[model samples]
Target: MEEYKKRIVKTIQFIDNNLDTELSLEKVAEIAAYSPFHFHRIFRMITDETVQNYITRKRIEKSAFYLALRKNLTVKDIYHQFGFSNHSAFNKTFKKYYGKSPSEFRKLAPENFHKIQNKESKNGQIDTVFDQYICNIENLLNWRNMNLKIKVTELQEMNLAAVMSLGIANVEPSYNILIDWAKTKRLFPKENVKMLSVYHDSFKVTPPDKVRIHACMLLDEPLKKQEGEVFPETIEAGKFIIGSGEVTLHDFEQCWVSLFLWMKENNYAVRKVFPFEIYHTNFKEHPEGKMLVDFCIPIH
Candidate 1:
């Protein structure tokens, strides 16, 4: 694909990974590796609708899915969950696209789900043009309901020096960069170094510019950096909730989401330490395109 097309694809994937977060144009542009003004023009020319319109449409569609499948969650909860500011705002836009109020649609959702899924506008227009979410509603809900094995353990503090990155990392370009740097420096030895990452922000909570993701190696000793900053930080000693399973790179976001949900249900409070991951093996060397990873989040 051409550069702009590649960037647009990445932007769409970013939206998928962060549907619960605020997706401003500037934030989405960062994922595409483009300036905000330039990316907006290119996106509009290529996608027709502006970026804001696209995000709003996708959110509303996902909201519809939530309304149908998540019976326990209230409409108000689903409204805010999809990032709408309030009921009035969600209702007005929802009616424009779905041609019914939120409650009206919810009441009819069970018997008329097929109709809702195939719903269209009066002028034969697409209620929302989408390449993914509309087509995969069942799979999305099923994945959310997955059961994963977890463990709670207490561990001592760890010291790490990482090459931190700021961007939408669903594809983990930052991990690639850090591994390349390690290869040049002969870091992360089989016995001497551990490959780990200290995630300083939640993809669902932190702003794109302020996210702190450190693609790091366990250091035997603190060493001076040759060029970029190497941060020395502590992974505090505490109890932790660990979600472990054989998973591919694609499963990282959902895995974390599930773990946090598990924590809430189990009544474990999140301790204010940046969560980190421990890889049983490197991704490049894994034969199945999957690896054993212990996703460790500190807890009280």
Candidate 2:
């Protein structure tokens, strides 16, 4: 089962990286090293979604991210970038999922509205929305003001043993699983082991309860065999913008938001790779109960 899951995860990663291209079921099945018929059933059984559904949903979610954050890109540009054939199909599918046209969704995004307000306020408009979103943005900016250091660096490919968690609340449990697995493998004395949490979905685009996170430990060498729910994965070598700081649980979301804001301010385009955090010290053991981490965002 672990081996099967490892192949499925590889297929998912491939699909995520190649979202802009055509992703046929047979092609993805081959990635999992399974016959198309059997792969389809197994994928659905494990992921609780059909392969095509997963592909479409991911495309739509990514498109939605572009719509909300990359306001400069027109709806046509986004749809085409995500491999949609035409405006009609894209709009229809997007509306079905979001209950709004792409334009409407973008217009309704609080972050976009906040930016617009900032521009207008400079011209004496001064309108404001006293909502939770405003508070969140302010908190993010406050955290950014803490002199968070960001640097661009290249990383070599990393081998990881990971356990997948479905939501933020389950992340700790996932880490526990990895920790125990590491102990059994005698990979403890974790002072040298790199612990990371890979974000598979953007919290801004996906619901908090539905987000996917992978709790991973850097492996010195690839595992000889899979163990239960833990599986082997790799983070390909790439250039990344890393934000390093000590952050509390309450400031975690703000840290990510601030990093993206920094990326935008610096005119950096995001790569298809998932962003992740590398922990230097566990919050549970910190004097101030803060996690010392480096949030790494891949860039083009």
Per-candidate TM-scores read 0.49, 0.77
Per-residue lDDT tens digits for candidate 1, residues 1-300, read 245654675576578558789898899999988899998998887656688977886677667766754577899899888898899999999887766788987887644443333334587753422223332545533564553468998987676666555445432765665666667778735563577877754543233443456777766665553233344545768899988878888887667766766676687766647788887776777887887788898877
Across residues 1-300, which tens digit of lDDT does each residue of candidate 2 receive?
767777777788788888889999989999989999999999988777899988897898788777766766899999999999999999988876666687887877635433321112354532322235445666767768784788999999988998887668889998998899889988976666789999888765555555779999998997666578787878889999999988887777667777888888788888868899998887888878998899999987
lDDT of 1 at 24: 88
Query: After aligning candidate 2 to the native by TM-score, how far in Å is the CA of 154 from where it should be?
Result: 3.9
| Clashes found in each candidate (C-alpha, N, C closer than 3 A) | 0, 0
Please identify model 1 stretches exceeding 4 Å from their true place: 1-147, 169-173, 180-185, 207-210, 222-227
Candidate 1 lDDT score at position 253: 68
Note each model's CA RMSD in angstroms: 9.8, 6.8
Runs of candidate 2 exceeding 4 Å displacement: 1-4, 18-45, 69-74, 106-131, 134-139, 222-228
